[model samples]
Target chain A: MTYSIIARCPHTGRFGVGTTTFSLACGRRNESLRPNVGISKSQAFYLRRIDPFVLNLLAQGYTPAHIARLLEEDDPDFEYRQFGIIDRENNVFAYTGPRIGQWAGQRVGPYYAAYGNGLAGPETVEGIVAGFMSDPDAPLEERLLRGIEGGRDAGGQRFKGQRRPERSAWLRVVDRLDWPRIDLRVDMHDRTVAELRRIFEEFKRCDAYYQECSRDPRNAKPEEVVMSELSAA
Target chain B: MTFSVIARCPRSGRFGIGSASYTMAIGAHCDGAVRPNVGVTVTQSAPLLRNNRLALNLLAQGFTPQQALRVLAENDAHYDYRQIAIVDREGAAVAHTGTHVRQACGQRVGGGFVAVGSMLANDKVLDALVAGFESQSRADLEDRLLNALEAGRDAGGLKGSKGPLPERSVALLVWGKHDYSDIDLRVDLQDGAIAALRRMYVDYKPTAEYYEERARHPRNAIPAMEFADMLKNKQKAMS
Candidate 1:
């Protein structure tokens, strides 16, 4: 019922998660992130409580593969879940449980993990990887959003000949700050991927202003002024 | 730094809040609390997360909006810097704007809704918000709330040193009978936050009922792609 890509940018060291699902609030439930540490995603019967534990394991110097093994050993419902981990060093690992659902699969690439359950076919995960790899020089957030869009284009979730819409979508990126650099969610929408992209494009226009606001509040111009300047330019 | 409207749909019994601010993450920071069948509240202008929870707790205990406001006023030491609005399940709405809040700060109460703001461009902002909401009394709760926020923004949202400030963040949250929200969309950091929020709402509107149907009656619910195909076929036949 869900498809996602978790990756760390080699250029900026930023970690991000881009995801869409047939249910509601996939953004709030599936992802866990620690700035400068790593990113983790748990789906396919996702337990929201496990995300923090995954982050903690990453903080403890556990590799992505090691963390998956530990989860398989410790969690009783591990067989029902799919996990993805990408550390700050761009080390990546992904796991798809056998009993998760039909058309479930995962694809691992350098610094990224693309995975899904109840998808239309293996092409969904393949599209995600191709999208992410298509632009190594772009910002991590853009690449992640594009990756999920590629999944949607390749045919999203499907079960028993009935295709489900990607109703909820989210994009979360964290830099070195305690807070996320970009955190956007479409909790419920027909065009989840498109809506996420629209907002991301809008946010990108003033992304610099926000960064300045966080870094130096006193000297930062109001967002309106910055926008006007950008438009004039 | 912010302006918002918290409302309940008398027709559908849904609670919704729409907010826009010059600051980042207004949805996470300024959004107070919303409980299904209880009430909705928003606290801004030096907001405190605990106050939002407290207000919701009080409303859940069957307190009126005004009474909840009084409790928040009495317990909060920095009440003078805070602005709060609450709408109960009964459609009774109330708001408090402290005297120490920034210039152009005020609030307006209409039937089933409360519009509040601090550091606004002018007093017209709240009035426009109220007018926009009341104009769409027959619309969905989410639509009405978004209309109010858009009207507020058009009337000049935040008051900057020279002119109207740009909204960096905006959010819309609507809750039906379910424990989860029917819609929870946020433009956490954007210059045209209200516009982005409106786009999200428009995109989400068509699928709202589908999700509800899926949750309530999974056996009868049509798959989203199949549903889209059906609609396309219907359109083709009509054409």
Candidate 2:
């Protein structure tokens, strides 16, 4: 019922997660991020605590693979959960428990992991990887968006003949700052991926402006003024 | 950058606001306070968050929507940059769209509802919104509000350099007899925000009663997961 990509952007040192699900508030529940550290996503039969715990382990200098082993060793309901982790070093690890429904699996790449449970097929995960790898030089936000869009295009979560709408989607990216560079969510939408794309386009226009505002409020132009300038240009 | 509808439902005595904006976090900045059994207010364009609370406070003090708008207009320094709409408990509606707001900005006052927009593609957006709401007079308040938002979008929402601008955020809020909102779905920083809001409303509608029951009588309420499974099975059977 969920698909996701957790990645580290080598170019900008940003950690990001892109995810979609046939559930509500996937953005709020599935992923956790720590700037200058790592990112983790715990889905499938999501336990809200797993993401924070994984981040804690990363903070304690544990590798993603080591944390995965610990989870398998300790968690009683390990078979029902799925996890994807990416560290600041760009090391990636992913796990899909056996009890997660059919069409579930994971793909670990150089700096990212694409994974899903109750998907249409393996193509969904493959598409996510291909999209991420399609443009290595692109900004992390764009690549994350493309990855989820790829998953959507390749037929996202499904159970047999019943295709589930991607009801919720989120894109979160954090830099060195305490706040996220981008935290966009479509909590519930029949076409979550497309809606995400639309907002991304709009947000991109002001993305830099907001960063400027945060850094130098005295010198920053008003949002409306900046928007009008863009429109005129 | 924004368009909204504030309305009171005569059938259920609920108050709701549906709004979309070409800005991030419209739910937090544009949507006003919705006090159950009191009134609802939305302040857009160059919105000041404090105005929402102040309007609600005035409404709670038995001030009419029009009177509340006048007070807000007088106290606000950037009055010309604001667009506000209010719907009170008695079904009276009032709105103010300042002259300094962008082109195609206006407000429409109708029976128990006020529709307003700024930086819109055209003035027809408000007309379509009102028409959509009026067409669904017999439906639930949420349905009517959502329909109006969709209609506004169809009529060309915010103005853009090329054409109609895509909405980045949207929210649907409704306050019933309870102190808390009955439905408060938001799609913050997303395009096709209105559509997303509608989808949320659809998904949440069936669960609303369950949530209320759990809140009021937790011991008698079934486990949420079990209830969800039951609903899923019922949906499967129906399909």
Candidate 3:
């Protein structure tokens, strides 16, 4: 049904999620992030509230594992839900509902969690975890993008019922702001992961400009910077 | 330049985007950001990811779709180089196409959607996109989006980009309240990419719900059907 990655950026201390699926907007329905709280994603029979709920508990100082246990205890439909949670402290956790679609599970790294349900095979999550862990020094958004790309290449969504590739994808990065620093989606596309890569390249190009604006929106002038990048491109 | 639409499903609280272009993977590079219960925003043409980030942030901060554009334009030094569209959770919409975009560029904002285009063969491409969405209001968000994409193709996509030859790239996206899209598909650097996209969607739609049910009630999830059986049906339908 879906594949997702949640991570804490060592550079900016932000939380991010990059996700995609055979379904529609996995980013919108699956992800929950709050500044200084934690990141949560509910997929595979996703319950939207679960993300917010996990964030609340994370804000209340619960450890990632504790929060997962608490959520499991609280939901009668827990068996139908797959989730991943990562907090500000870089604590990571994941769960797969007992009844989730085939090839459903997750992998956790020191500061990241990658999970999927209805995946093409085990390689999906494995590749995502490897990609996320590949470049520890990269920006959070880039790492997450790599993870999703890996998942897609290793066989993203289940193919038996349809096309081999997943149709939609989303990537989001957040820092101190209430809004996402990079929020992008391919809601319906055939080459979802490849498209995500192109958009991410643009995001990387504009990141410095975004940082400049964040520093001083009233006076920030990114025209020179952007024009320079365009020339270079 | 490209032709694209961002639409909402009033019935299912879904948001979809469909676009075609002479460029490679135009939908991926310049598509929008969607938050299921919040809103959607697209930044295209001389697309600036910084402005796109700003727009999505503004939308999250409770700016109206119109206000978000105003704020972005006010802050961007190269505002005229951008094209943007937004649809709030409540279905309100707004769009902006800058003068700096390629010739034949424009955007239309309707009740719950926006269609924007640049370097189009004709203004009718956008019109066809809108008409496709309107005429197929009863279809699922994915089908509606594909309909719009198909109509835009029929109306002619990018100028000098269409013939018996295939499109360089195309993409379709539909977002519901799930972590995954109801449909997230793209056709990049392919001949007949639009046709390929339609075929891909048809193959996926029927089984989408089975996976959804697997998520909601795995206890009752259907057994994996044989791939041969699924292909037979697909082939039969194609015939």
Candidate 4:
């Protein structure tokens, strides 16, 4: 009934967790971050309480597996929830509920993990992760958008029930600063993953394009720094 | 439907913007400010990048908040449907909410006090803010802002919003006038916003002052040293 994509980008000392779920109002419910502490993404079978749970675990200095095991054991339908975590240690952990719909899966990498449910198939998430990891030359956001597109192309959340299911997702990652940066979401859409790419391309150019409009000192009054929207590569 | 009014408090170099949105993400979307020359608020609409950019430009041209809003409205296609608030380098403020904007309107009560809100919220939401800002004798930007937010929420916020209605909220970009303490906080999102930004101002809070001194003059990092001492003192004092 829903599709969500979430990942962590650890740049320098910054860590951010960005995610988007096809379920209406997913952004408001499924995403959470704790500055340099760690990133926790609990969706599909979301457990809002997991936010504090993850924080407690990290505070206790528990490993990713320990927390994962706790979450899994605690939840009657452990296998149904989609959980991904990346701590200050760069360790990655992910869980897929046993009762999750078909074509759901997850994959982990050195600094991030790509998890989705009701997707086209297991290969979608796997292919996205691999493509993103292989595109070593691209900037962080580019790699993430590439990974999302790869999944969407591989038959993302199935098109059933409705004439066409609204394919919506969000992408977020922090670049080593522990600052929750790069937040973007499309509440609803029917376009293929490619169209989403074009939108993200604009986002990647100026992540804060909406707010960056006033950076120009020329944009500001005379005394302010002449800031301009200098798109990042 | 959401109604809101916004404005900037130009304190010479540092600037601050104040806005209240009927929606939960108002703090994230409707407010944006910078130190030195400009403060802006984009309310009751999708983030308008075009008007936002123009507002900054107009402010730089020495237009007061009123002038900037008039210019942006005149050239905007959705002018009637968009509401905005601005303050330039001089404490001057101006605001506009599209005429089509209903049950959603706002007005400034006193200098540096702008209240705008709508979205199932009682009109008192904004009125409370106006009263809080105008009534409170507080001079600190942060305190005033918190008071305004507190007043608005108590007047019965979304009551049953997407979430349990925020007991605690955040103000992302706050530039204090007395001291150049500018706060740029991104509560939640997408990516690089890679703009290398300055976290603190050179003259305001202790942190900024310390950093400033460390970069300039050979004087002992007075602020830095004092900060360390303060932390230690605070710890000891608590102990």
The TM-score obtained by model 2 is 0.58
Error of 4 at B122 (Å): 23
Residue-level lDDT of model 2, residues A1-233, one tens digit each, is: 68999889988889999999876756643238888889988776655557778888999999999999998898766776788988899888888888665679999888889999878899999988888888989999899989989988888877756677887788888888554667777777678899888877877787677555433344555466677797688
Residue-wise C-alpha lDDT for candidate 3, range B1-239, written one tens digit per residue:
56788877889888878877654455545333666677777777665555555676787788888899899889877677678888888899999988767667799899889999877778888899899878778888778878887888788776632322236567777777764455666665455678877876676666656655554555665544443367568789989
Q: Which stretches of candidate 1 lie over 4 Å from their true place?
A: A5-18, A21-102, A106-115, A118-168, A171-183, A186-233, B30-32, B74-77, B212-223, B229-239
Q: Could you estimate the TM-score for every candidate? A: 0.61, 0.58, 0.67, 0.48
Which ranges in model 2 have alpha carbons more than 4 Å from their true place? Answer: A212-233, B1-22, B26-185, B189-202, B205-239
Best-to-worst ranking by TM-score: 3, 1, 2, 4
Q: Write the per-residue lDDT of candidate 3 for residues A1-233, one digit (tens) a residue.
A: 67889888877889888888765445444238777778888777765456777787888888989987887787777877888888888888888877664668888787788998878778889999888888989888889888998888787777455545576788777777565666666656667788778766755666576555434444544343443456498
Which 10 consecutive residues of model 3 chain A have the lowest summed lDDT?
Answer: A218-227
What would the per-residue lDDT of candidate 2 be over residues B1-239, giving only the tens digit for each residue?
Answer: 88888899989989998888887856655333687788888887766666777998999999998899999989977777778888888998888887777778899998788999987888899899898888879998888988999999999888854556788788777777754466767788656878767767766789756654543443355644467679889879988
TM-score of chain B of each: 0.87, 0.92, 0.87, 0.64
User: Candidate 3: which docking quality band?
Assistant: incorrect
Better of 3 and 4 by TM-score: 3
lDDT of each: 0.78, 0.79, 0.73, 0.50
In terms of docking quality, model 4 is incorrect
Individual DockQ of the candidates? 0.12, 0.09, 0.14, 0.02
Question: Evaluated with TM-score, which candidate comes out highest?
Answer: 3
Off by over 4 Å in 4: A1-20, A29-31, A159-166, A175-179, A192-196, A204-233, B1-106, B109-239
* Residue-level error in angstroms, candidate 2, position A157: 2.5
Model 2's chain B yields a TM-score of 0.92
True contacts kept of 1: 0.08
Question: Relative to the unseen true structure, what is the Cα RMSD of model 4?
Answer: 18.4
